[model samples]
Target chain A: MHDDLYLALRQCIIDGDPEQAIELCQRALAAGIAALDAINEGLVPGLNHVGEQFAQGEMFLPDLVMAGEAMKAATAILEPAMQKAGARRETLGKVVLGTVQGDIHEIGKTLVGTMLSASGFEVHDLGVDVPFETFAVKARELNADVVGVSALLTTTMTGQKNVVEALERHGLRPRVKIVVGGAPVTRSWGEEIGADGYGEDALAAVALAKTLLGK
Target chain B: MQPKLEILERELIERILGEAFTLIAEPGVKVQAPAAVELLAGAGARIEEGVAHIPEALARRALASAPREFFLHNRAGEAVVRYGGDAVQFDPGSSCVHILDPATLEHRMTQAADLVRLVQVAEMLPQYAAQSTAVVCNDVPKETGDLYRLFLVLLHSSKPIVTGAFAAHSVPVMIELLAADSGGREALRRKPRAVFDVCPSPPLHWSEFAGQNLADLARAGVPAEVVSVPLAGAAAPVTLAGTLVQHAAECISGIVIHQLAQPGAPVVWGGAPAIFDMRSGITAMGAVETAMLNVACAQVGKHLGLPTHGYLTGSDAKVMDAQAGMESGVAALMGALGGINMISGAGMLDSLACHSAEKLVLDAETIAMAQRVLQGIRPRGESLALAMFAQAGLRGEFLKLAETRKLFRSEQHLPSSVIDRGSLHAWEQSGAKDTFARARERVAELLAAYRRPALAAEVEGELKAIVGEQARRAGMEQLPGLGT
Candidate 1:
């Protein structure tokens, strides 16, 4: 019976049905299966499958985003149960993300956040037009392991450097890894801005975050 | 009279526009510029998380104010290139990074001298009505590259230019360069000697830089050409018609932002769309489907009574071979027949990554043929060919007749030595050169014949000072290819 429940949970994520995923989580709880097992044996494996398909070009951006949505919804349902049982999901790191100030481009930054969260990172997306101080404050409050700044315009990409300086001014530079990305951000630009790393795209961002945390 | 080609049916175009307007109001366009968002919100567009759901009524209002025609003027203030109503013109492709070396048969990074040579060659060719910043100069700093190109074009060529900016900040400076050449900002606006090409990101999005450019160009009364690029099956829908709907939506939203900033600004419904080759993962600019997409997209623009432009006459071949000729020739004919007002991409190859001056000369012959085709068949006299036949009287001497002499010059298109029409004996005497060899010779002859156009000393001094300041700001001591 537990095996069937785990299989159904995996199917919920692959099919990207958030409501169905929530229903299955409740069923797992009612059937007395551990919430941690449901996630480790079911949800993570399903997301891994989606990631593999995405890398192979079998899946696209919308599919990956939907799968991420299903995972987020399913996790919310089991969080209370997992805490009651003194269980925890393994996280790679905590990441604070946003499109830098004076720029409103959101698609790329949102994609990077979703991918990081789905890959087991604790993501706090600050949203678009975020001030540099907000990034510093968030990193200090959340004790984030990584901070990713995005800018889609050549004119506004200078904000990435401002972000790096803000982190240094707050003395959060040593603890937090800085990763800059966008359509205009390049590897050399990241180096020039004193960023720890650069993500050419969302997938690369996730991988770079993992490497930074030594996972 | 000119022959015309239409790919989309009247009903299909209406359906595409209808679907496009619905898309604009539903998913809306993701505008990254805050000022643009404010303008749309003030115009009654529903804003949701930076996406503006523009109403159909607003788009129509913008379209109504856009001018249906505009002119790009030469340095002498002659209206040489028209952008409306089946007036076909051609210019070399813009912003290539490599120039193909005829000796090495390999691509090398371009420098300021390469661009100067291209401008000089293009100036002598009557086939290219306007000039383009044909190649990027690798010697210059990246931040100042866009302005540096325009400065070089103004200094080297007398023709009006088609150029674009890499960033929003660069746009104003480039415009200032043009204004300095035209006496003042208002004079430049009145007889605009240049048109800036602004592109929007595909799948219903416009980056902040592009949005800002649209607004600035509109307020300044400079012409803006909206180059909407949608790669099929990758960034957009796989089907051609579906891509057209996306293209129309992007362009319609761009026009809305442009016209809202300033009413009655000149904008061209232009695009450089191509099919994504699934096998190679490249945008095949030379494919027939790409040409169809360009022609059909222009058809939609014409249906709305707007000026049209398309990127054609480019090839994906690596060299000046048969593939280059076939791809470039066919597309040039199709674009001309389809009535694209300003057809670009003449010397471009390798999917628009490289430019070759020899290929530019060769493509001029191809363009000459296409222009001849556009003339179609016309009756010159009352009896057609009967008068010439009567004068010859079955003696097989029509070539010697006065009527033949008088009419053949107008009737026949006399291509240059780039195209061979001599007998084998004559060809051997001329060294039996292939088309590329002949094109190389032609390029050399044209460059030799190029003469710089005269400019007032004060205007020249103003241009030098402006460009010199920019060069210093970019940390360069002196400009490349310009002697003190």
Candidate 2:
């Protein structure tokens, strides 16, 4: 019965049925399934799979956003039991992320922000065309362990170096590991610019942030 | 093959080139590099010493005669790097000297072995055309940046190289080094093993170094790909239309130089430009808009009736993490969809700063899917009728059809382990590994099974000796494990 409920919850999430997830959580609760069990065995696992499929392009971003909402709803329902059991989700690390100025491209930034959030990083996404100072300001405000900046041009890729230089001028360098990414960034580049980390893609970004945060 | 961009159909392409030619003739390119201007003048371009006034008729005539498509012959398969062919081929660029390892989360120095392994894997993938020359081995010297990457990639694979030199001084030497493996330098010139990239500064200009490189590479008969980088909102016109015009102008001018250097010489109109980041002021490689602009400009190249190349396959989504997968996948998908010829920048990570073997494998799987997507559907005569459908029956399942079993595998793409096909329970059984973890294992397996290409003993000796000579010239006591 536990296995069946778990599978059903997973399918519901994969199918992107938020209402069904909430309904199933209620049903599982009535069936005497522990709220913690509902979350651990049902919600988180389902969403993780959802993220995997979405990443693989077996599904798309709509599926991911819906599954995120479903996971949130399930987590909310299981909150009391989770708190009672002292179940704490370990945040990998806090990341202050944003797209650099002049370019308004946001999908990649939004996708990273979403994945990082789901991966348990506290992401402070200072939306599109973020000003350079905002990064230092937000990193300080959030006490962020990593600052991830995104640019998408040969001209704009220089902005990543500028952000690191700005951080250095403000004495924010080394205090917070700054990572830069976009279509044009390279690791040698990260080293050339003295950045703490560089991710070729978004998932690696999250993992790098975790490492920087010492998770 | 994806359908041609409607607005950029053959007639329109001819028309675009016509307009581009007019722009070039009326306002010849401003050659910022005197050496380049001299070369162009010497080669036949109408130049009054420093200024090159490219005639529109010459630009169009040269491109009109140039082939619209070409093929890179590799053992795996003939990858059609089509300006207009079966599909666009994407090769990740060469030589990022550092990588942020996802496993360690720390930035580590990159090595030449990393590049060799990457080229081997990139060779296996259907997406890449000629493994890139940018493999940097940290164990080797770093004076030439990624020349070591190119050397090892040559040693490891026979794939054509989509590479560029970081320093102008090394371009000829590197090309000479590449020739050591095949026939003498002259014979190597015939087959054209590598495509040297030349970029014009956007807003209609060319750097002294880049311009000279273009002229010299053209003189060498090595295929030259003129890269016009117009960063929208930065070095380029902010509007997309403006950017395309600037791109056309640059390519037209470069084409005139290339043709005049040696009329009928091969050249690919290419670029890796993206919009500038207004915030920190950098070129962002991960923006969808950048990738989109890349495709649109490729349309301009097609308009010029020339084969187009764009280094649009890498993304700065940073890590090989989810962000990397999505951003890389999107660019790969669009690039294939747009039918770009010879798309470079594969396997790049950290926005383009790093290259990962694992991500190379994963991107290959993504390319396979994207290639399938670009294939659209093949409606052969056998597939045109309801007769086969009748055999499957009404309200029916394909699982029960004998024909379904026969054709399913061929019709559908069976993705590598990079794609998780396991159900929840099966996935749980497999230790619930993430995509990155699975990709890592797959990378290990592919590398383990890799067989190095065979070279004639003399060729092998020569290739090794070149590296040895280079090492010696650089004052190395001995060359690393490159066998003589």
Candidate 3:
């Protein structure tokens, strides 16, 4: 019976049915299954399968985003229960992401946040046209392990360097890794701005985040 | 007699425009400039927190006043590029940061010398009707880079330029540079030698600088080409029709602002729309869907009887290979058949980040082929080849006939040596060069054959003084040598 419940929970997430996934999580918790077990044995495996299918070309961005939504919904339901039982879920790292000032381009930065969240990194997306002070404030507040800056236009790309300076002003450099990305952000530009890494796209961003954290 | 292509039917275009009008009035467009907001508000648009809900009637009034066509003139005062109807012209893609290195096949930061070389190559090719301020000069300070590029194009080529300004303040300075070349501001306005491209941020938002540029160009009587870039599935709706509605909304709002600033100002409905690649998270400029969007967008523009422009003939490949050829060639033909007035993006690669001089030469050949295709099938004589068949008879010796010799040149497009046609043995005997290799050699020959057009001594001195003064303001003591 427990095995059947777990299978149903995993299938719901794979199907991208957020409401069904949440119901399954609630049912599992009421039936004496551990909250951590529901997340580990059900939600994580479903997200992992979606990732694998995405890599193999069997799925697309909308599919991946839907599955991420399901995972997030199911996890949210189980989080309070896990906290009541003194449980903690393992995460890769905490990342603060945003598009820099003077650029209101949102899609590229949003994609990075979604991919990082789906990959088990705790993401704090500050949204578009973010001020430099907000980035520094969020990094200090969240105790972020990594901060990713995105700028789509060449005119706004210099804002990435200003972001680096903002983080340094708050004395968050050296300990926190900075990864810059967007259509115009290049490896050399990242290095020139004193960023630790640069990602060509969202996938490269996830991989670079892992390497930065030594995962 | 031109072979035309249409992507959107008449009914569909009406429906799209209807939706676009509703969008601007309901969700409204975000206007960052206070003056633009005031202009729209004074014109009866509801202003609620910097967003203008423009009514369809206001947009129609603006459209009615907008000029249907405009001409870009050369230094000799000849109207060379027409931005109306089915007249198609091409220029290299503008403002790329990198130039593809011929020796290493790598992309390097483009400098002033690189921009000069690109202008010279474009000046010699009759296939390119106008020159573009094609590449960014990394050698200059960022503040003055826009004017520096225009200065180089004016010195090297007498062709009318397709260019843009990055900052709002630079618009007037760039215009001043053009005026100095054409004798004065009034003369430059009478025969406009350049068109400035001003783009709106996607999903119905115009940045402050972009809004200022539209007004500045309108008041100055210079042409402003609105390049609306809607990245499908990212900044815009994923479906092609949905994106078209968004494009129309953005462009109509721009026209309203431009015409309000100056009634009867000229504007071109231009775009660089692309599909956002889901797998790679990149804007796929080379995709067939992107071409479809451009063709459909221009059809909507033509529906309103306005001048149109598009970005095509670009490749996503990092190198000059078969993928580059297929992508660039297919889109060039599509843009031509769709009757885009001014097609930009030849010599662009890596999703429009890099420019290649060799690729520029090769694209000229592709442009030549597209122009030939535009001249649809026509009967040369009264018999439509029947008389020629009567002369040849069963002997099949049309090669010996005088009519054949007289008509073949007009009938066929004789491509340059860049396109290989000789036998395999002959190709192998002459170093077995591929298209890229042949293109590199062609670049050298064209550069060697290039002679700079002479300008009036007084006008030339004035041009230098304007550029030099701007350079000093940006902390540069001297302008980079043009190697003239």
> For this target, which candidate reaches the highest lDDT against the unseen true structure?
3
Comparing 1 with 2 on TM-score, the higher-scoring candidate is: 1
Best by TM-score: 3
Under CAPRI classification, how is model 1 graded?
A: incorrect
Please give me the total number of clashing residue pairs in predicted model 3.
0
**How would you class the docking of model 3?**
medium
| Per-prediction fnat | 0.00, 0.05, 0.45
The digit string of per-residue lDDT tens for model 3 on B166-211 reads 8989999999999888778898888999999999999899789999
What digit string (tens of lDDT, one per residue) describes model 1 on residues B1-484? 7898899999999999999999999999999888788889999999999899999999999999999999999999999999999988899998887789988987877888888988888898888999998888878887788899999999988898999988888988998999999889999989999888898988898888899999999988889999998888777898999999999999999999999999999999999988866543456879999999999999999998899889998899989999999999989999999999888899998876789999999988899898999988899998987887878878878779877788887799999999999999999998999999999999999988878788788988898898888889999887886631
C-alpha lDDT (0 to 100) for residue B439 of candidate 2: 85
lDDT of 3 at A67: 83
CA-RMSD of model 2: 16.0
List model 2 lDDT by residue over B13-112, tens digit each: 5554565666665566778677767765664667654557776665666676555655443323344344354357778765575565757856566665
Quote the positional error of residue B201 for candidate 1 in Å: 1.1
Proportion of true inter-chain contacts also present in candidate 3: 0.45
